[model samples]
Target chain A: MSGIQDFVVLTLVKAAPLIYAALAGVVCERAGILNIALEGQLTIGAFTAVAVSFATGNPVIGLLAGVVAGALVGLLLGVAATRFGVDQIVAGTGINLLALGGAAFGLTVVFGQPGASAEVSALGVPGERGLIVGAFVAALLLHLALYRTPWGLRTRASGENPRAVRSAGIDPRNVRLIATMLGGALAGLGGVYLSLGELDLYSDGMTAGRGFIALAAVIFGRWTPFGATGAALGFGALAALQFVLQRSGVPSELMQALPYLAALAALTGIAGRARAPQADGVPYTE
Target chain B: MIRGLAIGLALALFAAAAMLLAGANPLLGFWALFRGALGGVPQISETLVQTTALLFPSLAVAFAFRAGLFNIGAEGQLVIGGLVAGVIGARLETSGLIAIPLLLIAGSAGGAAWGAIAGVLRARFGGSEVIATLMLNIVAALLANYLVVGPLHSPGVAGPETAELPHSSWLPALLPGTRLTVALLIALALAFVLRWVFARTVFGYELRAVGDAPEAARRAGINLAKTAFVTMALSGAMAGLGGATIVTGVLHRFNVSLSPGYGFIAIAVALVGDLDPLRIIIASFAFGILQSGALSMQALAHVPKDVVSFVEGLAIVALAARRFVAGRKQMTALAPE
Candidate 1:
């Protein structure tokens, strides 16, 4: 039915940001970094995108700025985790808290508002087609780059056995650092999509646990790009169903909980079988 | 200790920079912050109220951290606990003397049940507590929102919250004309008890061994599964007690925004206290001062109260930076090449 087709199309559009974030998680985790700061990265990306778009009147420029902002945070996280020997989890938590507080401050300082920013120019494309297509393309490109390229092999090797990566005359540290940065950039694109393609403005705490859910997708998909993207799309469909369920006498708040419950179910169900990178979250001594 | 001092100084400097960016005089803002938190009886009482709220969650985090598990679900546990306490307080027709203890117990029970979900998943299914707990936090939030908005919605109430608890159910106020309640004393007593447990009990020794090295702990005849489950349950109980106190002692009703990320901030408090119970008391009070002072800072300096959050984030980052520097120094000492 055309109604079902419309529903599917709408769900895919809603899933673009989550797919991007899940792919980002796959990249970082594959490089042996467990980035819990995805939430912060997404928040900062959304804030910067809207701010730039509001000032420049160009959503594309805003999108680019968002990626840059996320990458910078990633660079900080990399330095902390790889160079400084901070626990990756702690460093990620610090980043998340920092981004959260900083975004709130920016909301007041930069935008002269408290809870949210004023609306910015919307992306030119309708129905979020641009972001939807971008998500599919990224999924395909990242999958190839991860599986079919030597650099991808090195990244995966670094996560599995950093000592082996070192013996192969490559610094696993640098690879992880670059991977985390790229991951942040991808996450930024997700945030940009939320602000420019999905909504016209940014609000406080707007990402609403999407980053954590994306991490769940990475786990459910066994840390593969295509699989993670598929999980994200599945979550997106569930999210869409929540709206539909609201019309059928279900409490909206209970419906709102379905996505999170599904994530937990997925994490628990697959946890026993899923294998994580060996060196994930372990600090490199050398 | 010296490293902690250095981190403190660095955090202060970072906060000053944040204040400067907010177009306020750093010195004036800092003075206002401290003054507002400690200037008078009312100010100190407000700080103590915050300290009381933070104490149990900090202990909860520290307890789980000692067992080498990160339990980030304290927020969810707290919410569930508070909701149960509220529901009990509303429905129970007992004397205040009987109702208060019952409500607290019921809250802890609710939180323990919620936490057991993660514990079971982690213990039996090998699920990462970090991921499981994080997902559950959102679910708990949604559940709380649903209950408050649908089943428990108070008639004629303007906000999304339950009806107030009977006056008899309220915890006795410790400070007259202030929000400070017997919760502070209760928290202090629990801290002393925890200190003794960590110092003298065999369970404490097992906990330490597990945290230090699980393989060695297992080899020494410790039951990893039992310890993991018990530790998580106890941790959740602490957070639950805190949430119950917040409802019965502080708010006297369940409100959705009762906590402003106290669960997450408690992690910093635990680490800053070095996971020591007595020291956590002091650390919680210090953070309590910062939290209570943040509002005044906004009113006086026109700085966003979120600046305090920035400062808290900066503290964690500063501690991480210190560790990184120390690690490099150790490496250099070892290699010297």
Candidate 2:
């Protein structure tokens, strides 16, 4: 019984960050900006959280700083896509490279070393539990806000038909920019959970493609807030299973690959013929 | 051309700012970078080797972009190709003449198969190639790690790499002592061939029509699904062949860390070259200088070598505008009145 309880706890702990990132994807794609920069946002958030924590010795402030940093990176993507008319995928790829390179550079500058930073103040276990609960709360709130609010209608309408939003006297670009920022903030908090809630220090590649995994969760969830959270929890359970089955002679690499493999399988219509938002990844031009 | 020059200047400025932030002299960093990349015969040869390594994937990326498909899984395809080549080369005992072509073909086939997975998904299921390719990249890495380190582990090898290929399987050297080999010539010939194909082939015209105006191409009776599958497979073959060359010519074995994001960087190269196969060779050389010079820049200038990638990332964002404008122009030109 205790083992079952522990597994449940571990699943929530693992799923927290993925839930945040998947939510980020849901919001951005729903608003017509395919935020391929979610990985970059996560990287920046994790790095900034650690750097600020190391500087001020306050984990909470680091948390806030991380969210703001992520939002700024999201803003960069929004401006480039909406204002400069840059290809979103290209811009997202660029941002991923930039965030990775910038963080590696930052490690040398801030920590006076490469590869990792020294152990710093962390949010501890209670904070971690709080975040796990907050993830569920966030999902519920997103579901409500997306389906029940006027802003949600505008955001969804923008994704389905941005020209219609424009005809209604609201610039869809602003709507997209705002959605990206909100999504970025959520993803930033996810990063904070990884660095602060689970670990005490920052290491290069610590995020370890979790950002990409979150992308899979988004698709599996069919681009809905509650649905994405549920998919994230399933992935989290798989991660927990990996830990349990590590000593059972099963290769961990294969285990680590299950989500990606599932995503590939999903592309074959095994998951469903669920359609994405019409204007998703399509840049709206004036 | 002017846009390329401006982007170069901007990258230089960004590099300088990064140096300043790192407490290094920007001038010293620049000097070290150029000196390391072009100082002597050895340095230049090393730069060319880097150039050769980058060329295959850059051209592969340009190929798919011309077909309006983003083949982001070049990294994965390259790994699978190298893995197949390395595994086959390790065991095959034959004359160099026979072994080289066989191994290269195997590598290309491996990459094409990997690429065809995404192609099938897009062609049959009407799925997004972006997500499929992205997922495949991770799967490729994991599969390579499993194969090399587990069942296919090379005897007497301590690391997660295959046994070195027999000497007969090795690609003949172009420069006796340097790592540069006939692979450079092969890559150059491929670029010329690709240029001709794009300019003069009926298939090329069909591909361009699909990329520039998909609806119109469909109306013209072009098979969009078949074209997507074929283009992706061919793109993957180019990247796979690049991997095979690396295994046979450079490393003589496959290691899981075969590419350091070359596939992703190839996107920048393709875009910078304006998706022109011939011009990608030039772009590859420019990026190659950075790849070879970064180590020296770190050692001598105390600047982080990551500055190169950072600047490359900035360059991608800045240059992406060009692709957008070009794509828009093509669409407008082909739009029905």
Candidate 3:
């Protein structure tokens, strides 16, 4: 009983970051943007959170800094995709690469270290139970915002038929831009959770492939908030299982691949069924 | 082409500014980068070697870009190919003449197989090749790590690598006393061949049509699934060949650091080259200079090597934005008054 409870708790904690990221994906993708820059946004957010927290000795300030940094990146992506008509995938790839190199540069420049930063103040509660709880609350709030609010209708409409949204007197481009910024903020919080909650330090590439995994969850969930959250939990369970089975002497490297493998399996297994939003990747030309 | 050059030049200037801020003389750093990449015979040979390693993957990326498929899995495909080549190179005891071709074929086959997984998923299941390929890359990396640290671990060797290949399996140097090997020649030949294929071949025409308009190509009786499969396989094979060359021509043993993100950099090369095979040759060499010079710049000028990556990423984003600007103009021109 204790073992099962521990597994459940660990799974929830592990899923917290992914839950935030996948929710971010749901927001942008639902608003007709691809948001492939999640990885880069996560990286920048993680670095900012740790750096600020280390300097200020306040985890809350660090978290807010991460959110702002992520939102800025998201806004840049939004402007590029909407105003300049850059292909979102290419733009996202460039941002990811830039974030990686930029983070390394920051490590050397700000912290005077290479690879990883020194430990910073973590949140008071152990194991980041607060973040996990906050993720669930955020998921619920996002679901309501996406389903019940007038803004939600406009966002979905912009994704499905921007012309209709524009005809209805709402600027679909602005909606998309705002949604993308929100998405970035959420992904930033996810990064903050990883750095301040999960590990309490920033390591180069510490997010590993969680950003991409959230992307898979977005697809697997068929662009629904709750669906994405559920998929994230499923992925999180697989991650927890890897830890549980680590003592069985299976090569940890192989086990390390579980979440990605599960994502691939989920994608392939559910392919041709989960239809994305109509104008998901289309650049809005004025 | 002109615009890409302008963007590259602009990014270089920006990077120089960054170097100045980092406490290095931008002019001296630029000069050092130039000399390290192109000055002496040895430097030129190393540049060619780096170009050889980059060319195949750039071409691989270019091939897929032509087909409108983003093959981000080139990193994984290259790793799997190298792993196979390392295993085969270590085990095979044939003459160089036989062993070389055999290893190359085996390596390409491994990459093709890895590429085909994403291809198959996309063709049959309608999965996004981008996500599938990205995930597969991680799996390939882990799989390679597992093999090296476990089954293929060399006896008495501390690193997670296979045993060194026999001397007979090593690709002979094209320039004696230098790292330059026949791989450069092979890469050059393959570039021309790919360019010709894109220009003259029926399959190439069909693939382009499919990429340009899948629905129209389907109406014209092109099998979309088969084309997707073929394009991805061929792309993967090219990246695989690159991995094999790295093993036979340079490393002679497989290690995790065999590729310092060459596969990812190949995306920038392909995009900057505008997905043109011939142009990719020039782009490959340009990036090859940066890759080789970065280390020397770091060592001599105190400029961090990550600056090259920053420039590469900047170039890609700027180039992509340039495309958007051009696209906006086209849209305006086509819009009715």
Candidate 4:
């Protein structure tokens, strides 16, 4: 029981970033935007957060920097997809490539390293109860904001039938931009949790495809915040179990593949039913 | 064509800028990079051989893209194809004449089966092929790792790699004094065949129609389900062939690190190629050159080879960003009907 409890604890901690990222996707997608840039945003955010924390020796500062970095990318994507009427998917892909390239370039320009940023000053902040609690509270709050507010109603309306809402005299494009930027901030927080809270270092490809899995969670959870977070936790549990089970006679390589398989199962199991925002993958106007 | 040339020019400028920023003379770096990639007979040979790997996988991706499916699982297909071919080629040393073709067939069959799994799910269950294939890639990768580590640990070999393949199973060399094998010719021939099938067949026409508009394709009495299955199966077969050739032709042994995101890069190649087979051959070589040049760039500039990744990233970002600027809907509307 203790061992199980320990695994659960570790799993929830690791699950924090995934939960944030999935909900981030959910937020943007709820506003009728598919945020495929989540991966790139997370990667750049992690890189920046780690870099800032290293430079400033403050985790809070790093967190803020991460959010800012993510929001910058979000702003570009939002403008491209909304104001410019670009295909949101392609714009998102651009964001990914840009972020990936930007991070790599930054690494080279700043530290002259390839795989990792210079050993940064580590942040011990949110190392325990604060981190897990932060995710749950966020899930609850985002769920509330998404369902229980008039603004939320407008946002949902924008996603479902934006043309109708646009005729109602509100700019759906503005709403989408806000939604995407907020999602970016949340995703940036997830990145901070990785580089600052857990590992205290930044490495190349450190998100390790978690952001894509978070997209899968967004699908698995059918675009709901809590559901997405739940799915994220499920993935995190499998990930944690892979670590735990590796010690119990399983080959390390086999364990390495289990999280991906579990993610696939989760994606396929719920994909047919993972309804998107009616306007998802479509550029919004007005 | 003009746009592509402009893109190449922009990328050249970007590469030069990157080189200068890395504290190396941009001219010197470009000289080394270009010379390394396309300088001589030897260099060109290496570039083409690498292009052989990139072309097959990219074509695999481009074929699936034509069906509105993104198969990021080429890595898995490549590994499984290689593993089956390698294991069979080395271990099942029965008759060379029989075994060589059999290994290729078996390897491709393994890749097709793996690819078809995602196709089946997408076709019948409406599962996202992207997720399914990508996950399967990791699964296949680890499976290869397990095979190398446990069962195929190469007859007293300490590391996780298979033993040398039987000489008879090896692919015939395409050139003297180079590792270039008959696989290049085979890949080129298949690409030509793919082009013919795409241009001439009812199947290919329907594939285009389905990709253009799925519901419209169905309205035209085209069997949407059939198209999905066949296209995915064929796409998987291409990637499978990619894997098999590497085993019997290139590596001749299943190594776990046999690929480094070759599958994802292939997606970029497919897109940049505009999903045309002839264009894919060229696009594959372009990327092959980038990869080949990257190593030399690292050695000359003391910059890591990942700098090439930045350039690749810049190119992808620019291409996708072009959609955001020139914009797809605008161009579609402007085109003369």
Candidate 5:
């Protein structure tokens, strides 16, 4: 029972950021925007949030800065992807690489440090239990917004069949842009949680492929909010378990490799059936 | 293409800005970066030193990407390969002629097995190779850490690294006092063989066909499952050889940070080379120069060392964006056709 509780707590904590990023991914993708830039968005958000929070001595400001940073990146991606008709995957990847560049430069300018920013005072968001609960509510509400609202209808329509939606007098590009921005804002919030809650500082490449894990969540969940949330938790369990097993003096190296191995297993197991949104990587020029 | 040039230029300028912060002229910084990396025989020899560390991984990444399989696990694969080398280096008592090749083969086999595991999972279970490979990289790294630090660590050394191999077993240095070894020539030979395999062989055609469209290849009886396994295995061998080269040629023993993410950077190099082995030479030199120069940028400008890393990140972004733009244009062009 104690072991189960510990696993549950750790899993929930680990899953929170993934849930956040996956949820955001769901929104953008549903709006017919294929976003590979979530990784970059998260990195930028974490970088900005860390610098601001550390500089201002306020976590709230850091959170806001993170959102702004992510949204800015989203806006760039959206503009290029939608307006200029860039390949969605390529543009998203570019966005990620650009974020890496920006963050590296920012580290020099803002932190006067190498590799990472110095430790900062972090504001307490909900911890283990609170994160799961807050994320659940947020996911549910966002899911509702995605399905029930007028925008939701348009967004799904765009993703499912953009031509039909356009024929119905909707602008797919605009919807995709808005959705992408919204998703980026949420992912940024998740980045804040990672830095603030986990390490209380920011470092180079600190997200450590969490963005990609969230991607797996999005795919595992078939772009549904609840599905993604669940997938995040599953991956999280694997992650937390790896850490736990590492402490047992077992060849923790192998254990350390376990979560990734598990994720790989999950990816291979589900890939053929999970169809990406129709025309997901296609740029809608017209 | 022009946009890519612009982006590259913009990134180079930003790097200059970083250099300026260190109180060095950007031009001078650029000169130092180039000079320190490849100004003379010694510098060029030194660059080759780093080149050996890079060569195997680049080939590995390029090979997989050619097959449309993204093997982000090269980092992980290399780690395991190094561990294999480390383990063998500590344990083996045979002559260099036998033991060195044994260690090399062991490293290749270790990496191949690891990569094959991911490949099998993806092919047999319908998993996403990208995610699986990425995750496996971390797993491999950790497993190595555990082995060296806990189970296989040298009794003499306080660190997690294994005991050094016999002196006779170590790679013969090409230049005295330099790290460059025969691995550079071997990598080039491997690259040529890989190019031939990719272009002239039946397996090459089959792999390309599958990469172009798996369903079509399946319909045509390409045995894609086996192909994936084989490609990953080949990739692992190349990457593992890269790790062994690093150990035997440079570090002369396994240690952490031996990779410094050469595996990941290979992604960028593969792209910049357009995944062409011949083109990779130019791309490799360019990247190698930038990396070596970045050290000088750090040394002279007092800028943090990541300025080169930022450039690499920029290059990836530019390449991806360029691909996207090109794809969009092609789509439109094809649509009109």
Candidate 6:
């Protein structure tokens, strides 16, 4: 039926951004850096994509710029955690605040407005469909790269035992820094999807905590690329169901709260007792 | 002391650069900021009110940090606290003497319950409090929105807020015609009490031991789970008390937007204060100036007040380096002394 097809299509569309962000989370946490600034990266990416598109009238170029901006933000977190030995949690929180505040400030500076930017050139419906497909492709590639490559082994070693990675003559900090940058790029693309792919404008809080939901997905999937992708798809389905159920009698707030509540329940080990990386958030100080 | 001065200078420079980007004169923005925060008695009183609102959450954050737990749910706790106070205060018709304490207790209990959820998760399941608290914060907001607008919506109210409390229940203002109230004194007294508790109490010793060296504390037979639960509950209580005061003394009703991310800002405050309760009062005051003066800076200097948050975020990153150094210094200080 068209209804079932529409629901499935809607689910993928909703899941695309979350899938990208969860993949980002999977990469970073596996590399031993807990990237709490995913929200900030998403915000900066969405904002920069809109700003660049507004100036250049090229959505593709804006997409590239957005990814670069996100990588820079991730580099900020990586340097703070790896080089400065700053607490990763604290630095992540700081970066979130900075990215959010900076984007709002950027809105005033670039668009001559606060709260949102004017409508800009955006990726067309075809581009959006491509992005949705690209999300699944990204998940597949990450799974292959993580499980099959030597680089993946090193990255996993860095998270499990950075000292061991160092014994193998690789600097775990560099590994973490690279992972974070890649993760940031993935998250940025997710933001670009939200701004350029889904909508033609950037508004404050438009990302609407999808980044955090991706965090939940990372956990629900037990930090595997494919697992996280699947979890993201599940959350996406929930969101689509929310839209469909809106006409019914269920409270929208309660529906909106289900993912968070599920996350909280997951904390109680309801999702199974799968363990995180030993050095997931530990700073690699030498 | 020199490091403190350097950080201050760096913040000033950052603010100036932001103003330049915003096409505003840095010097004029700075002047407006100060003048708005301290130009007159009224302005100063407003600054103190902001300071008072910030102090409670800052203290709560510091308390949890001292126990080696990240209580990022203070915002949620504060909201639940205020919601409980507002809902109860709306229905009660009693003397101020009886109503005030009862409402505040209810607020604290609400916050403690909210906090205890994360506490139990960590203490019993060995879960990360960070994730638990973060999820709870969003849930708290969604829950508050639902309660205020749906089932508990008070008649005659036009927006998503509870009914106003009776005049008798309103906190007696410290300065007549100003929002400042005895809540300031209460927060200040709490600071001193916490200072003493940290300095002298057995529980404080246990808490510091857990924070400074958790494995060693476990070896020393301290119950880590119990300590985690108690610390989180107490921390939530402090934040809840702050929420109650805002409802009783400042807003006179519970509005979901009563705090502009004060809970998150309190992390920066707690860090800048070096996790010391007494010093957080000073940090709260410093940030209070930013909170109160931002509006004037926006109105007069054409600088987006968001620059304050940008600077605060930068300050958090900059100050994180100092906390690392300070932590090392404490480690050395504890060496066989």
Whole-model lDDT per candidate: 0.82, 0.88, 0.84, 0.76, 0.75, 0.88
Per-residue CA lDDT of model 4 for B98-187, tens digit only, reads 877898898888888889888776776655566678678768877888987876667866666677778888888878777688888888
List, residue by residue over A71-123, the lDDT tens digit for candidate 4.
87777777777776655654565566557766776777767677778767655
> Can you write out model 6's per-residue Cα lDDT over A237-272, one digit (the tens) per residue?
999998899889898989878888888888888878
Clashing pairs in 3: none
Q: After superposition, how far is residue B20 of candidate 3 from its true place, in Å?
A: 3.8
lDDT of 3 by residue, B44-130 (tens): 999999999999988998788777677888888999889999988988899999999999999999999999988887777656677
Candidate 5 has a TM-score of: 0.86
lDDT by residue (tens digit), candidate 5, A1-286: 9989989888888888889888888888887776767888888888888889988999778878988888888887887778765556545655666677678777877887668888887766544345457678879988899888998888888887888878988788888888888888878878877777666788888877777777768877888999899888887888778777765756545543544554565555444566657755556756
Best by DockQ: 2
Instruction: Report per-candidate DockQ.
Output: 0.52, 0.66, 0.51, 0.42, 0.43, 0.63
Q: Model 6 chain B, poorest ten-residue lDDT window?
A: B328-337
Candidate 3 vs candidate 6, TM-score winner: 6
Candidate 6, residues B156-272, lDDT tens digits: the string is 998888999999888889999999999999999999999998999999999888777776777799888888889889888888888999999999999988888888888889888
- The alpha-carbon RMSD values of the candidates against the true structure, listed in the order shown, are 4.3, 2.4, 3.9, 4.3, 4.5, 3.1
lDDT of 5 by residue, B1-337 (tens): 6765786688789788766764568887787888888888777887776666666787898787666576767887888888888788877877889887888888888888888887886567645455567667767766776777776778887776777877876887788877778878888888788889988999998877666666666779878778878988889888988888777767878886678778777767777777778777667777877767677767765666666766676566456433313322222122110
Error of 1 at B125 (Å): 1.3
Angstrom error at residue B307, model 1: 1.3
Ranking by TM-score: 2, 6, 1, 3, 4, 5
lDDT rank, highest first?
Answer: 2, 6, 3, 1, 4, 5
Q: Encode model 2's per-residue lDDT on A1-286: one tens digit a residue.
A: 9999999989998999999999999999999887877888888899999999999999999999999999998898888888888888888888888889998999998898999999999999998889899999999999998999999999999989999999999999999999989998999889889988899888888888888899899889998999899999999999999999989999999889999988888877797776778788888878
Which residue segments of model 3 deviate by more than 4 Å?
A124-127, A269-272, B321-337
What are the per-residue Cα lDDT tens digits for candidate 1 across B1-337?
8988888888888888888887888888877888889999999999999998899888988888777777788888888889889877877767989999999999898888888887776666655677777778788888888888787777776776778889899999998899999999999998898899889999998887777667667779987777777888888888888889999999998887778888788877877888889999999999999999998888888888898887787676555533322321221112111
Query: Lowest lDDT 10-mer window, candidate 1 chain B?
Result: B328-337
How high is the lDDT of residue A204 in model 5?
83
